[model samples]
Target chain A: MIARNDRLSGFRARLTGAGLVVLVSASALLSTPGSLEGAQAAQEAPDGMALYEAGCASCHGSDGRGAAADRIAFDDPLPDLTDCSFASREPDADWIIVSKAGGPVRGFSDVMPAFAEAFDDDQLQAIMDHIRTFCTDRAWPRGELNLPRPLFTEKAYPEDEWVWTASANAEGPGAIVNELLYEKRFGSRNQVEIALPFGFAEDSSTPASSDGGPASDWGVGLGDIEIGYKRALLHNLRTIFSFGTEVKLPTGDSERGIGSAEFQIEPFLALGQILPGDAFVHLQAGGGLLARGHRESHGTAEHDEDVREAFFHAVLGRTFTSGEFGRSWSPMVEVLASTHLADGAQPQWDLVPQMQVTLNTRQHVMLNVGVRVPLTDADVRSTQFLVYFLWDWFDGGLFDGW
Target chain B: MAGRWGRGPFLPCALGVVAVGIVAAGAAESGAVTGRIVVAEGQVRFAGEPPAGAEIDMSADAYCRDRHDETLMDRPVRVGADGGLADVLVRIVNAPAASASSPAPEAEALLDQEDCLYTPRAVAVRAGQPLVIRNSDATLHNVRVVPDSNPGFNLGQPIQGIQSTRSFETPEIGIQVRCDIHGWMTASIHVLEHEFFDVTGEDGAFTLPTLPPGDYEIEAWHPTLGTVSERVSVAAGETPSLTLEFSSG
Candidate 1:
């Protein structure tokens, strides 16, 4: 009888515990429904304050504000999303959609990636839920139309600054090269640039290499001056025209280098998008005419007198923040594709991948680590690697007047 | 009387607009929503056994804390080698930022590398964030991030007591981050951009805090366990606890 009573007592205790759990759960479940629903969906929300901190805070700032916007010194300015009185005109749903899909159509940076794949629907809702707490005014003012222009705090014209960039790179079977480029942008959408590049390779490796050439030293002496103009096609899109003559002085003594004097006219088109603050993407495409001169004493075989050729190239690039290790840093990547279309010659194709580390928004250092493979059999198949530093002293805002 | 223009057609248009405005205002003011959320703590099992020594963290502790506990679940268990319980990543998949002064709570996962192997073979964090990797052993280790879609980095930490904190700028799920110094040191990083996610503790307990109260989708992630998500209803100032069970095939 005593053992049976002990068993019954234990069973009763378990029942009481289960009952208490049920009662408490019921009470908590009835407390706040809307907020709980919003919170539950928070997992998939990409624009939530928490989400922004984990993904974008290192550069754009924790408060949805940025420091780069203040230093633009342009007539317009970067839009401040946290300005409740101004941003309230935009609907919350619209904001969430834009944040998830990105703002390229709205003239914002492509660097502000589309988070639909990164975040789930619930997490996206959570971010919208958070955004609702601030920037809550959603009524547009009467008779005021939205305008598409670069946001700046000062004037865009009278930009008088010079930027010089130099970079180099080395890899197995690739060239150790250096390049120096300088630029200055004036008020009339016309910019001046000077570029010089030098390269040397020990054992250059192509995709299909049967013979090896070790201790092969190649050097190039190049000088180019160009004038270019950029104009807006639409809100964030632009059209660029560059027509200039480049004079190259061949100085390579070995078989691996070019031994000829050349003149070229390069025309390029570049499209750029600036995100809320410092992040951006620049896509560019261009073609040019290259005219060669013969220098027989320097081992010239391909060109005896004058050879004319045309070349085209395209680049897609992005720049964003990286703060995983320490303070904020900018990291960028660019893919280059080009082809030289000349008569009676197999089209020359080259692919190059480059990585860049930013010292600042205006100054950056680049390292090109990929090898280029040539498809044309008649043209020499040479691999190229590059390391170059780039500086944007003018911020490209000088063309605002044009 | 005839010369005076009567406000006929214009009067009706003005009155109709006023009436519509009043009705819209009334609808906006009277709309109210109510609901509940039950936070289900996910389980972490290693080959049919509980995983011991697991640290679970949630981004927003306020909303889900009442239903969940702060202590690590399955605290006294260890995962077996033959595919039983392993430590899970307890995290908030997505949560909102509070304010400038009042920020979201911070969380961390410390996975040690001992005996030339990763302590926890899997981990998760927000993308574009920093992850600290260390070698607890008295040897050198090279950390190499192998990603398919983004440019990966390879770094060498050649001394003991040296830790390298690397940032992942791109969003890649289920990417492998391994060590070259010790060929056997392998770990996986699952990057999620949101804050409302959690991994199971050894005891199979998890708590999410700072929820604003309402319905939510609670998602549980595991290195080998895949993902399990459920809708939970939570009340304001109240905790609603729940349980999630998983079965293997």
Candidate 2:
């Protein structure tokens, strides 16, 4: 009987020990936050209340009661932090460390990010200084830590001017073209330009058109309105996106002039890099999709409506600011090129070069004169020249008296 | 001549061995420090009338919130000054090897947010034991922990009236906890691997349980009052009581 009892007892002891091991293993797995027992150490220390308000209130709400239950659609009710039984039993330092770092310890979201970078030791100490106010049973002695205000620098706007410009180009509807242009500055970085060009064709054999003209049997004058917007994307980068419509205003013959209004949208991104000695260089490139409805005989030519040609454009310019005649001015040379891919069999290209002189600081003005030359042998002999004037509306006073 | 030579070296060697033995024994005696941590007063004090809340954070940030470098925030205790439970955390910092655990510790650190306040304002645990943080209130709590001298972690226990458990793997200096909803509620946590520590009860009495026989550097960490440390010694299977005074000194 003794021998049999001993065997049974040994078996029972083994089973019990195994059961205990399983329970402990399970419990440890549920409790451990990995190899770093930092949470445990934090549980040992305590933090202050004021510091908690400054850092944790932005997201966790001001009271320990929790955020508005309706806002986040929480699945459960949040507990209030004032319970004495709960408060008195908590470890001292655990919450302090968690507050400084963030709320990942308790499986909460990282909305309350770590403030180690923003707050220094002294500043963090001051925030902690505020936390001591929450302790009813304890007293907090204020320490020595002071904060100073920062300084700000003011900026003055530059002066501007109005400029008149004229240009001639040989790539449109007529042999010669005249354009009157005006531009104005509304603010430090914004400007508006308007131009009206009239073309008179000698032979009326050109394919393209400018603005305002009569209708001819062989070649006719077409008009175009161009609106543009210039926005600074960065310190040295500016983009210009423009959209315009081509309207064949009635003059004499309706058959040769542009039939209806054709729409066009162009977005250009450019970068200007300032070089040494008050000099700068700018480069811009962009693509535009043009659509035009073909006209037959004073009626809707729907069948002729097709995706015209893709147009590619590029502009390069260099600016010079110092001289004897101008102050705070830049005289720049500009070159622009465009290629059309509408008729797949043969493509037509236009090359333009212009010179511009800009003066004034706040009332800035730019005067430009250029010519457009076609490089294709398609018997399209047309040219144009344009002059424009620009003025600043928001000029003078503190804006320009830098 | 043979007898004289043999006796000369043997006598001196024996004496030298005896002296070394005595020194080792004395060294062991000086390395043992044991003591107890208890509430200094009868119970936690209340400045005004205790509110009609479910739980209260008696510590600086309620629940005796603990933090090494972060802010101190508190939760309102539900029980007025008349409540019975006061959470307190006791810790051991920078102790001698003889006072710490061997390889890993066998104790546990419990962080419970009951009645919106941290139960046991402060606590201490072995280096390898699990630290359990549970939300026992009826409300929702997203426990945010800010730690010092350690990597911080945050967790949200969305369950209503359910317990949420979390553990720390590394031993950090100290940490603090807060509810996203209730900013008034706050608590503290500390991680260590020593055997000598205690948390003051509501009646101001703390007992260091199951401490091995050795000398330890024990500290009483309070959120508002700061920390107090003392050297103590303990014998095998003996319980000792320690008193801490948080005065102007």
The native-contact fractions of the candidates, in order shown, are 0.00, 0.04
Clashes of each: 84, 200
DockQ for every prediction shown: 0.01, 0.02
Least accurate 10 contiguous residues by lDDT in model 2 chain A: A145-154
Q: What share of the true interface contacts does candidate 2 keep?
A: 0.04
Tell me the tens digit of each residue's lDDT in model 1 across A1-402.
001101111000001122223322322422333332343354335456666554333334455454253321122344455665434333344455545555332234333334454456666666656644444332211001111111100011112233332222322333343334444444333345444444443433233334754344334443222333333222211111222233333333223332122344444343333333445444444343445533232122444334333333333334443432111233334333333333443334444455555443212222223333333321333444333333333323322211
Q: DockQ score of candidate 1?
A: 0.01
TM-score of 2: 0.34
Task: Enumerate the chain B TM-scores of all models.
Answer: 0.54, 0.57
lDDT by candidate, in order shown: 0.37, 0.38
